[model samples]
Target chain A: MPRRVALEGSHAVSEAVRMADVDVIAAYPITPQTHIVERLAEMVANGELDAEFICVESEHSAMSAVVGAAACGARVFTCTAGQGLELMHEVLFVPSAMRLPVVAVIANRALSAPLNVWGDHSDVMAIRDCGWIQMFAENAQQAFDLTLCAYKVAERPDVLLPAMVHIDGFHVSHVVEPVLLPEEETVREFLPPSEYPFPLDPDRPVSMGCYGPPYIYTEVKKAQEVAIENSYEKVLETFKEFKDVFGREYRPVETYRVEDADMLLLMMGSYAETAMLAIDALRERGDNVGLVRLRLWRPFPAEELRNVLRGVKAVCVFERAISFGMGGPLCAEVRAALYHLPEGERPKVVSFVGGLGGRDVSVEEFEAMLRRAKERVSSDELEGFEFVGLRE
Target chain B: MRGELSWKELEVGAIVTEPGNAAEYRTGDWRSERPVRKQELCIMCGNCYIYCPEGCIVLKEGRYETDLYYCKGCGICANECPKGAIEMVEEGK
Candidate 1:
């Protein structure tokens, strides 16, 4: 039987890392993410987990250390949030480009200008095109499961790429919830030891991070794009195996109450749970409302999303991060995914940017947002985007 | 220098499977000038051998020569020679 215990989201991530039997962990402390590395440090000190816990000075050094370790055939793990991620911005591309299977857990938080340190999608969205397999977790349980699955997905021979699991900082990272911790033997069976095909060794040395001039840069990028896009199949396969072993099913685009509904609300991260409650209230009032939660961000699951939105009449996307002059990043991507649908089948996508800088997005706000989306669909003159729950 | 593999044959992430594949690249093609050694004026201080950026300077037996196939003709060896035994001459001269 699996052990069920109430664990904080960050602790759940640490426990998952421990069970994954990571050989190295290089991380710098950042808000919401600090607890994760802290717990790992304790585990190492207490001899509970045998791993090299490197205390780096900055996030850049932390990422660089993990990249070096992974290249040398070590199963490495790391965690970061907000500005720490921003500090490691340039280093983020190297691991994926080198095809090193380094797993990182991102406690998603808002970026600075106002210098906020709270939960949001701004951090992850900033590096959406960094060539890593990115996934979002709505709760503590998914955070633990996805962290383990990330290793299995990244270490696959056909999909030798770095992976990141994003948990909304403060909202998901700080929340204490009951999580079923899998046995060590089961995790070991599911995710066997990673064997890198080409690792840096003195006896058999290989040049990594070689300079690519203009002549081959385009081809290199094309190859990377194809690899990431193709890994979608491997991700699904890994999730299926995980479900069989652990009994927890995960999907790229998870839906709720959409069978008979015409209006759909789309969101990612922890806010999706709140949106479900709002959907229930609207359903009780005889309204046709449903919810669509996005789990995979990078290598965007366009096919799965298109299939889910096939018959939906209207879609209201709740975005936690704004793209300034443009609108919500999530809303823009959702619209682009649905752009190919025929005119008669396409749904009117209403964009709503909210919960930025750690601001709370209430259930009442979701209800009002849905009402606004329905009005726009009926009026046939939809507004571009709006900042929901803005004080002004 | 042309690439051996077509774009289709190229591996993802531009990984170089063979060790020391740089040896086949012939970086000497980048040279605008070449370093010529004067054996008569040579002191054999080995400064040129140490300073050569590409490590192309070779001391075989008692003779010191630059491996033109791999040298980029940076002229660093010529500049570092205390006895002026190495000279940078225009390539193909």
Candidate 2:
């Protein structure tokens, strides 16, 4: 039977991992993400979950260990944050390139300069091209739901790539919320057994991670590209299956109050909920504003985004991470996605950097950013870069 | 169009040993080289067998044997053998 539990987002993620019946859990302790692995460790020790819980030395080893296990045809999982993720940098390419369906939970946190453990999207945004399927959750419920969806989406034979579920560090990870705990049978029925196309059986041994020369390398990459792009359909299909069994609908990009609205708010992760609050308040003032929250980042929703922003006059792209010299990373990608469209049909896009180092982007501040964006749209002089609610 | 193997029968992606490598390295007759294992020094760790990259090694009676049909004379086994048990020696030397 399904039960409703009031649990923290990080705990919810751990619960989902437990419910998925993962074969291996390799993790290292890092701030804001510590509680998750700690709970998982408790579960493993108490025999509540039967999994090989490896205490890896660092996040690099954490990812590397999961890769070895997943390569040998084990359902593997791990979690990391901030510098921990940055430590796993190079190894991130191995799993997806090998088409291993390893699921990772990334508690979104800021990158360090003076060394701070706080909530932000900097860590996840940095590894945008590592060939992992990326998904963002708006709340603890979404976090729990998306983590299950990630395994289904990744393990699909046509879409055998790794997946990362991102939720803001303290904002979502540590905050307690009500999450619907689906029955074990429901999850088991939805996600089928994952086996390697060629397992590491000694009887019929096959070579993995072979060195490919230039002649065959291009074909390898072409197959990977086709696999990820083809996965968009499977992502939607899994979401539908999830809804049919579990009764929840998740789209690549979810819209909030967008119908009959002129201004669209573009953002991802937990910040979207705060933006929705601002949008609702603005709607009360008779402003035709809406929110478009991006759920899938890689195999990016290029067509879905263009469809959502098709008739909107102006768009304020709120980013939790900066790409340094190139403005916001999400903003740049969104612009590039819309660049090929006919000029007259494109939306006037502006970038806003907010919530760095876990500094709160309150509803009032979000409204202020929207006001500034609206002013830019009206005066036809909106600057490309706008830092919202900063202590300058 | 080449020596020994006709270009017509040579399929693509079939790894071929570089021609005249022994002459370039002051060694005689690269084609005759096969990996030979010193069993006394071997620990039977299977590192050579597992990392063959060509699936060319087989273990029988707790000793490693090389499958010569598909072994392209890569010498990777001799290069990576940690115990130094395997050596690339000319077949008739």
Candidate 3:
């Protein structure tokens, strides 16, 4: 039976992991993410969940342990944040390269020198090109929902790549919210039993993680690329199955109030929640403004993004992390996605960087940026990069 | 979990699973050469002893002897040794 409970986002994620019947969990405790591992430990201690929870020493060891477990044909999970994620950067490449179906929950936190535990995209962005399927959640509900969705998308035999579900640290991780927990039987029916194609069987032993010669290296990488590229269909199929089972549909890119709007704002993560508020406020004043929240980050949903923003006159990309001197990383990617479109159809996208280190972007400030962006669009003087909510 | 294994007279060769023991090798068990220190080149820097993946490299009378029984031969010791004190020749090569 489905359990109806007021659960925190972290607890909700833990609930889904428990329901998924993950065979092994290798984890370490980091701020914001510690709640998830704490809850999983409690479930194991109380016998509420039947699984092996390994208390690894460090984040690096945590990923390494999960990689071993997954390669050994066990459904595995782990969570980490901030500098802890930086420590595991090396092993992150191993799981995807070896094509082990491991899933990770990343509590999005600011990377630190002076040491801040707030939310940002720096940690996940640092590992963006590691060949893992990455997804961002807008709120606690999506945090819980996408946590389940990650397993299905990652474990597909055609797409045996590691996946990470990123949720803003304190905003979604520490916040309590109403989440609809699905029944165990329904989740089981939707997600098939994991069939480990390569398992450690004494009777049928095969080598894994072998040193390949140059002759086979390119072939190995080509297979992984094809697997991830082909995974788009499976992601859509599994999401449809999730919608059927849980009645909650999710898309790679979701548009809000964009039907008749000429101006659109492109953003991601928990900021999407605030952007929706901004959208609603603007619509009340008879302004044509909309928002597009990118859920999938890895596959670079180009066609879907273009289709949604093609008709819009102007687009503003609010990025949380800066790519050093180059400006907003997400804004650069969004502009590139629409670069090939016809001149008239291509929306004038203004890149804005804000919300780093858990800075709250007020709804009023968001509205002002929209007005400024529209002015830039009208005057044909839109700066390629603008830092929002800056003092100067 | 119960299986068939003869315990009465366990041969050394019985447990040392060689390549082609099965159709394919479990690369998980593949290890590097067990470093046998040439006493003449010994500089008791203890690099090999500290960096050995299996921690089987030990100092005996100012010389290092790597335990072949447990060593996977990752060659961490040979690679980490600052001096040319340890050489990792392939086992059974």
* Per-model DockQ against the true two-chain complex: 0.34, 0.04, 0.03
CAPRI quality level assigned to candidate 3 from its DockQ score: incorrect
Better of 1 and 3 by DockQ: 1
Colliding pairs, model 2: none
| Residue lDDT tens for model 2, A1-392 | 67889999999999989888899999999988988899999999999889999999999999999999987789889999999999999999888777788999999889999687998889998888899999998789988899999999888866778999998999999999988999888888887778656556676555555554454566666667777888899999988988998898999999999988888889999988888999999999998999999999988999999998876788889999888887889988888888877877788888899899898999999889888888888888655688877667
Per-residue lDDT of candidate 3, residues A228-340 (tens digit): 77777777887898898888899989989998898999988988888888999999999999999998898778898999989689998887887887888888888899999
Report the error of model 1 at residue A286, Å. 1.1
**TM-scores of all candidate predictions against the true structure:** 0.88, 0.82, 0.80
Candidate 1 segments exceeding 4 Å error: A381-383, B26-93
**Model 2 reaches what TM-score against the true structure?**
0.82
Higher-scoring candidate on TM-score, 1 or 3: 1
Give per-residue CA lDDT, model 1, range A1-392, as digits (tens): 79999999999999999999999999999997999999999999999999999999999999999999999999999999999999989999999988899999999999988989998888988888889999999999999999999999999999999999999998899999999998899999998999988888888767788877666777777778888988999999999999999999999999999878899999999999989989999999999999999988877999999999976899889888877778788888999999999987888888888898889988999999999888878987565788889877
TM-score of 3: 0.80
Ranking by TM-score: 1, 2, 3
How does residue A177 of candidate 2 score in lDDT?
95
Candidate 1 chain A, poorest ten consecutive residues by summed lDDT: A211-220
TM-score of 1: 0.88
Docking outcome class, model 2: incorrect
Q: CAPRI verdict on model 1?
A: acceptable
lDDT of 1: 0.90
